[model samples]
Target: MISINNLTFNIGARALYDEANWHIKPGEKIGLIGANGTGKTTLLRLIVGDYTPSSGSISKAKDLKIGYLNQDLLSYQSDKSIVRVAMEAFARQNQLHTEIEEILEKLETEYSDELITRLTDRQQEFEQLDGYNIEYRAHEILAGLGFSEEDQKRQLNTFSGGWRMRVMLAKILLQQPDILLLDEPTNHLDLPSIKWLETYLGNFEGAVVIVSHDRWFLDRVIKKTVESRKGKLTPYAGNYTFYLEEKGIRETIQRGEFKNQQAKIKQEERLIERFRAKASKAKMAQSRIKMLEKMDRVDDVDDDNPEVNFSFRFTKQSGRHVVNIEHLNKSYPGVPILHQADGIIEKGDKIALIGANGRGKSTLLKIIAGTETFDGKVEAGHNVTMTFFSQHQLEALTLENTILEELQSFAPTYSETNLRSLLGSFLFTGDDVFKKIKVLSGGEKSRVALAKALTADANFLILDEPTNHLDIQSVNILIQALQQYEGTFIIVSHDRYFLDNIANRIWFIEEQKIKDYPGTYQEYEVWNSKRVIPKPAPIPVKQEEKAKKEEPRPVMQNAAQQLKKLNDELSRTEREVETLEKQVKEIETELADEQVYSEPARLTAANKRYQEAKAALDLAQQRWEELAAGIMEIEEK
Candidate 1:
């Protein structure tokens, strides 16, 4: 457990936090949430002691072990195989096991009672530490992070940057520290892997503090939210969705009170000034002014929720069909990625495509966007304007240009004043406008790419994981803006809450096939529930047919006769319901009697029992109806 007190951090006169306090308790799962550049990540660094606070004290238990996973991963280029590196987390256990082996060998050679006792104690300690299951635990953690069994033997250097980041995550999980601090843990995870991590974190025994932009992931795992914004940290006792609703209600009340106090302050100031100018009332006015000076002013904090304001002024209206794909098949070397795929993008339709990572979701987007080609038909509509943001969309930006210049280059006719205004709306402020794209952070670079994309006025937009680097607050802004945009969109994202709230339809991509559901993602989940059950047969076969043929036989007749035995069971349930209903009616009759009202305790007890009996009767009636309906529906035919 840890607590931060009176933490004030300032760099070059810009204060990130002033007297901010944050607390972490054992076994607590918390989400650090805020808009981009609001100091969420900075607070994480401060907690892990990665960055010392400018002032104030961070009090933590002396022996508390903390594991902090920074965004810029330390490059894991080494001779050790991936499996060995993953197993390194169990180094201490392995060492203890080796010592136990040596002690056993020595015990066999020398007979010393004291030495034997010490070795016995050490063995018990090793067993208590779970030294035996270390390797198995490591393997389980590593595999959950998307590492294939075969890839375990391969060196870590062979993996790409994203895969290496997963390996780093695996290492942190394997460490089994007391407190785990993860920053952008979902950044490198595919959809399946993200879901896996969510379940894993939900059941994690240790305390976890995660900072991520994925709202759906947070909603599933975190039960509490810690919002770091505007030099303050506010803790809410619920998940992401619950926290949003609570924060909205709280801000509305706070803003209202703040406005009223401000108006009162102004009125008091005017009256005090007017009375001070009058000659005779000077003494009373001076006392009132002193009271005003001593009174605390309620500082007004607005509902500073970020707005998206997507102004995509298109150059021309797209054709009816924005894109069409037919019999698309592609392969590289020996593996077939997409097989005989067909899809279409209609004008003004917002479509969401979801699939696992490393699959052909991005590849399909490329084929449709014409950034890459396929073996089959991919047609772009006539006179259609198109803009695409790839998963690695930042690669498209011209790093040499300033943020303002970047937007201006796309829309040359627009003045610098208008360009700055546009950039400012996306959180690119005065000094940020002058910074070259080369020096911008990943989130900043994304804003730059987004600004240029909107300025082009493309009627069709293809966004691949656009919420990757954004925070929760910024993501909502993007969602509102996209919802208001008047154009067709084909987006691929793993954020289920976002898809549920914004997408009109979902295209579930799996097994080289796409299933289109004409509803929100939440509805899709409900529809998926039916697909889980085995469908009922049109008619009973096998045993029923054999029974039908042998109906006249005595043995078949015997089976039918046995049905009369179960009739007693059905009758018993029906009778139970009738008995309970009679009991409720008796209770009502007793309540109508004057003597029953004289005993308050008896009346209360009878009412409780009556309620219970009524519930039992309702359930028994439902069950009886279901059994009777099934028997009648099958036999009446």
Candidate 2:
């Protein structure tokens, strides 16, 4: 447990935190949320002793261990394999293992009673520490974080920054520290890896404080919410959703109180104005003025959520078919991205392109934007104008130009006044538009690039991870902008909440083909959770003949009879699969419940039932597939 008492931190003259207090209790899951530049990460660092507060103190329980994960870990590089790197978390176990090995080698040559005793002691400690299973635990965590077995064996330096960040996260999870301070932990994680981490943290015994822009993740994992704003920390008793509702209620009450106080002050002033000139009433008026001055004024609520007033304009409306792809084939070296993948983006189609990392989501986006080389045709529809937005575009911004200048150059048709107004909506108000691009942070630069991308006279938008560095408010503004736009767009983002609000269709790549789900991301998730695995490919002629020799085929009176029998069996199997699937879902829901997960016996029972139901579902699906395949064969004949 950690207690931050009257913590005041300042960066030069600006107080990032002024008497901000938060008590992180054991086993509590807290989400630290605020808009950009509100010092969420700085608070985490303050708690971890990386930065000392200007005043007050951050006191921690004696011998408490803390693990901090931040974006800086993305630069970590090592020649060692990822598994070896992750195993470094178990320092004591590794040391004991080394010592025990040395003792065994010594006994091979110079055996003695003292050496044997020492070996026994070390072996006992090693067994107690579970040293033998450390490597296996490390591998399990790495796999959960999205590393393949082969990837685990590869050197860490071979991976990109995002992948390297995942390695650092794996190492931290392996450590299992008493307190986890994660700053945007989901920034580099894919949907599957994020889900895995959510499950892992849900069952984590220690306390956790997370700073993230991901609302869906926070809603799923965090039990408490804390907002950092206006040099103060405000606590909410529940998750983000609860915080929003509670904050709204508080704001309404505050507004009422503010109105009542203002009315009282006005009435007092009117009385004073009417009677102050009379010598007899001067003292009473002066007394009332003093009381008014001493009254604590309730501050009005801050407008963190800004409305999007700017609308996208295009030179010409795009044709009904915005983009058409035909047999799209793209690959790199040994990695095949899309093979004969085909998809169409019609007018007003807001597609959320998503999948696990290394699934070529970005590659597909670039291909559609006409920026990447591919083997097949990716043709733009008639009268279509396009604009592409990616993180790489942030680097394309001219450092010497001011934010306003950058936008002006990008959209010459728009006047300076309109550009400034547009910039204001992106959180650059007053003199902020005059700041040089070089002085901006990564998030600021991303906003500038996004502003340019959105302001373009293009009907088709290709946005790849636009919500990467945006805060929740900024993402909401984007959602608003996209909602108002009639143009078609395909966006690649891991932010589920953002996607669910903006996308009307979900697009993902599976088996190297573009797959489209005609619904929102939330609906796609439900469908995907129950999607059945496809049957295996047909055997070759030689293998089929060998199988025929090894096994006897069932004889039927006629093809019609065989078809009817297979159809009937398939129908029965389908019903069984559905029942088994429902049973599995029920068990999974129970396992997800806090009461069941927190109780060992209940958890064990639920897990057992889940496994049994899953096995039955798999068997039923296999039979269904076989029956359907048999029906297909007979019908073909």
Candidate 3:
């Protein structure tokens, strides 16, 4: 329950918002999306009262509690344990608890009736607020966000910046505010933690407003989409998928209307020019001129943002087996991350290596990339040139070198124009190429690293969380570029949507073993969901028959029980198949629409969805068939 009426905010000469009216209702989940520097975060700050609007007002219920998680971690007590820091979320409850304890100590020393009454009142208030469970709740949130029990007792300063951000997130979640405002909450989280957050938010009773670049997370968590663009807020009534569909329709219609107006204006101007001097048509020509002057020109839709367009160029082709690992084992000190891991990477395989944090997904990638040593046989095939990109690779850049010089060092044969053009593709244009690496932000350094990797004529690319610092548009660009490349690559990423688009195979690492699934991430998920948990060893046939005879079959389904269970499963599988088929049809219809074909991103996304849905539908049908056969077998029995 927050409302903004005619909200206007400005930063220097730019109007971030002008007369913007938006209402966030109770229990609503909204996603804020836009290009980089489009004031998404600024709007969040304004709503949270950190920044005053230039004009208009933001209103909220007087009792509404807002928890805002900013991109930057807040200053915290370095010496305090993470659990203690998180417990501070319920400061009032903790204070009451402390006061109640003090009152009890006073009662032991012949306290007055007033002290007893105060203690009783404080205890009632604490119970009313569920304050007694505050410590348990804090630990639960910390564990869900990936802090081990030992980590909870560790000082906050011992954690890295990313983990510190996670601690802040845990604190916010523990507060359980009426409205949660998160900006890039998933930026620092691994896949497992992100999924945990998704489940937590799915069950949260309060309203949520998040700004994120993780499309899959947004699609799963948010019910509404709000775009901040050109000093206005546009709302979509559905999730990110529906938002994309509706946005495509609106842009297509807008472009058509603008084109029609331009055509009519051109025709009117031509007629006026031809009839200007005619005695009989002078009045008509003058009237047309006045009409032209009064007509508001239709501005062209602004959709032509510069897109990144470079592809990986290979100097030579690699053998069929690009990388082969056997009995790989790696450990650090007392921790063993991977053991007896074996896998093969073909020359043209695009593999997505995924797992929970500290489970050795990145370690496996490093081992395969030959950047790390291990106790296993890790071999590369003939002519397999590798280029690796990691956060550490960004740190390895020479801080004294300019962006242009960095690329030049990587490829000394490239001309200045070639270097500048390549840098421009990654959003470093003109004088930006001359900026020293020392002054670059993390995102800038990431882009430079990506650009360098792309320019290298490597046949096999090993990238770890390549899209961590990229915006949605840049990520799409990279996806498109990678889709067209003929090189083999192993990518470690938590972005499910990105993996869906690029990964042809899934290497899921669990319990120190690599399980290879020959499908996309979505397919892998469906398969994983359908995996049969090992059942306890069956009792002897005589015992089972004796128990069955002794147990009365009270008026129940009886003989049809097994059949009924199979029928229910069959029905569910059939329904899933139907839903996926429907999605495929809808995406196909959109792809067929002439308007959507004009936007490459929309077309690409639609096509990708169509393929994925078709694949899922096929899997569902197979599952349905299996269930039907099982039911028939049970009926015969």
Give the candidate number with the greatest lDDT: 2
Q: Per-residue lDDT of 492-565 in model 1, one digit per residue for the tens?
A: 88887777767887886544555588888888877865442211111111111221111111222332443463
In terms of lDDT, the poorest run of 10 residues in model 1 is 535-544
lDDT digits (tens) for residues 451-514 of candidate 2: 9999899999999999888889888889999999988999999999999999999998877789
Model 3's number of clashes is 0
Model 2: runs farther than 4 Å from truth?
Answer: 533-637
TM-score of each: 0.77, 0.83, 0.80
Q: What are the RMSDs of all candidates, in order?
A: 18.0, 11.9, 18.3
Query: After superposing candidate 1, which stretches have Cα over 4 Å from the reference?
Result: 97-127, 391-393, 413-418, 529-637
Per-residue alpha-carbon lDDT of candidate 3 for residues 1-637, written as tens digits (9 for 90 to 100): 8989999998898888999889999999999998777789999999988999999999999899999999766555478998898888998898987887676565555546586468559867987887756777787788778776566887787666777788899889888899999999988788768998999999999999999989999999999999888888999999988998999899889899899999999999999989998999999999999999999887788863455445456779999999888898886554555689888999889999886665567778878877777998999999999999988888789999999999999987677887787677676877999999999998899999988888888989999999987777777877877898899999998899999999999997755568899999999988876543221111111111222211212332344765676788888888898898889789879977877654444644664576467656765776687788877765665
Model 3 spans > 4 angstroms off: 74-77, 279-283, 304-308, 400-405, 412-425, 429-434, 532-637
Q: Please give the TM-score that candidate 1 achieves against the real structure.
A: 0.77
Reference-based TM-score, model 3: 0.80
> What Cα-based lDDT does every candidate model obtain?
0.74, 0.84, 0.81
- The model with the greater lDDT, 1 or 2, is 2
| Model 3: pairs clashing at backbone N, Cα or C within 3 Å | none
The true-versus-predicted C-alpha distance at residue 326 of model 1, in Å, is 1.2
